[model samples]
Target: MVLLSCLQRCIQLLIWPVYILAYMGLWDSFYKRVFPYIMARFAPIYNQKVCKQKQELFSNLRKFAGPSGQLRLLEIGTGTGTNFQFYPPGCQLTCTDPNPNFRQFLLKSLSENPHVQLERSVVASGENLHEVPDGAVDVVVCTLVLCSVTNVSKVLKEVLRVLRLGGAFYFLEHVAADQSSWTYFWQKVCDPAWKCFGDGCSLSRETQKELEKTNFSELNLRRIHVAPRWSPTSPHIIGYAVK
Candidate 1:
């Protein structure tokens, strides 16, 4: 069974480059364009799985609202604005994603969730949020993002830089399973191939460790298992850190 799986992966890896070359560097465009459609089909199932956790994570966001009685929230890697439904009524949200392809879907989501106002959508990576000013936002939210970033620590630093004093950074991401586990073994084996097909998302990132090492003033993070231990994304972290 293992040998057959290995052969299948090898075949995929061998063919993937040819597929990329066929696109002539337009692989990124194709991936970005198709990803939204894939996510649209998958989002409902994933959302249902994480609905409770998301509600808990986004609870009482109004407490962070400023004097104007509105929250200035910036979401990194805000693909299709999936979290918009969880946001409080008076939030002016700034969304960012490296893929411009997600903007149209994100706009549709914004229209559906009329309570959340769109500040703007910037095509930027999490590691370099230069377009957003320093200390300009009251809250930074990232879900399913850290695993894809080339540098998790650098992205956390950018989150800290953009958040105002006493602001919060909310994150929910899948991380590597216990090192001794079979899931971890598969995660290591699948990560490279996963990155190629999954838009640079690493299957085995120790995202919790990076968050711990970061300079957040208060870290309120915890891990939960949305799937059984055998699953690659079994163990997930969901919580917020005060800046």
Candidate 2:
């Protein structure tokens, strides 16, 4: 029985990579586009939880942004522009995504919200945000985005480059489990395949450790089990840091 179970596990691990690659190829074309639309269409069902969290994050950000509401905010991986509604009226917002398919959705959201100034561009990750000037942005916001980037360290470095001194970087991301041995084992076993299907997202990454290695200071970390948005069993980490 033990030998059979071990063989089964090994087979699962071996087949995972192929499945992940196929999944990612299909996801990049289909899931990435449709997922945002589905999320927006079903916003009412998810927004209560998502919005509450956004409100809290934005509130914390407001202390740094000040009374003028004149924040130069940059959002990386701004899919479907769902986060546009969360910003205050006077924010100078720029949203970027590698996928050009989201352009119309971004424009529509910007048009509806007259205060927002929109710029659509193809940025593969934070490293590719050369169009945005260094130390120009007051705040950098990333929600559920880091997992898909090709190189997280490069992305974080780029984030540091664009943010002004004392500026804040806010992020909401789901990462690899730390406590559960079984979950961690599976995350390690399936990461390569998972990345293939999930837009280069690694379930084993410790985002906080990456943040600590960056130039940022005053890191505030929070953990929450984001129920049933994407992965049913995964937990999420949300935090902000000063650059």
Candidate 3:
């Protein structure tokens, strides 16, 4: 199994340049035109195995948000608003994404899921979080976002900073695999090509490790797998931590 995995990875690495070079010209167009359509179609199927855990996170958020019945939920990298369906009632959502292209797609999802009250939508990168105010939000929900940032620790500190005391950071992100595994090796090898097409996503990012470095009061993270069989990006961490 190890031998076969290494062989497959080596072959993939050899061809990666060809794969990436082909997309270099058309990549922007592909992201603007095709990616949203693909995401809208793919999100529901992708959410199937994962929604249960996600719902649990929302449930906790609801409790934290309390009697005014409004959770100040800030979702950084709110891609195409794929998570709109999962947001619980009374969420005053503040959505941000680095990609300006996703705004239209996000609006469409917002219209469909009217339960999520859109407080504001900003074109902002998670690394800086300049649009958000310090200690202003009740929950910082970051799903599948940590891997792509310019600096994970900077983004995390920002997550911690924006959150009010007792507020939480909800995360569901794919991280680097065990160092001994073929997946780890392949992730490192394929990362450059993957990031180019994946909108800055890092296949080998250990998001849980970055989260641990934060001065959060509590963290409860667990590893899990999800499918459609995207290797090296399928192993994920899902949990919440209170500030």
Largest lDDT belongs to which candidate? 1
What tens-digit string does per-residue lDDT give for candidate 1 at 7-80?
A: 54775677688466546987776777888888777877899999998998899787777777779999999998
Minimal lDDT window, size 10, model 3: 26-35
**All candidates: TM-score:** 0.92, 0.78, 0.85
Per-residue alpha-carbon lDDT of model 3 for 49-99, expressed as tens digits? 788877776666676683476789999989788788888865899998877
In Å, residue 34's CA in model 2 sits off its true spot by 5.6
Instruction: Let me know the TM-score candidate 2 reaches against the reference structure.
Output: 0.78
Cα RMSDs, all models: 2.6, 4.3, 3.5
Evaluate all candidate structures by whole-model CA lDDT and list the values in order: 0.87, 0.73, 0.81
lDDT of 1 at 236: 94
Model 1: weakest 10-residue lDDT segment is 3-12
lDDT of 2 at 20: 72
On TM-score, who's better, 1 or 2? 1
Q: Could you arrange the candidates by TM-score from highest to lowest? A: 1, 3, 2
Best by TM-score: 1
Per-residue lDDT tens digits for candidate 2, residues 1-243, read 474456546756776655675666754566566655654565445546677887887776566663465678889988667777778767777777777666777677777778666543454556689888888788889876787777789999999998888899999887877645566565666665566555566777788788888888788878887674335236788879998
Deviation in angstroms for 61 in model 3?
A: 1.2
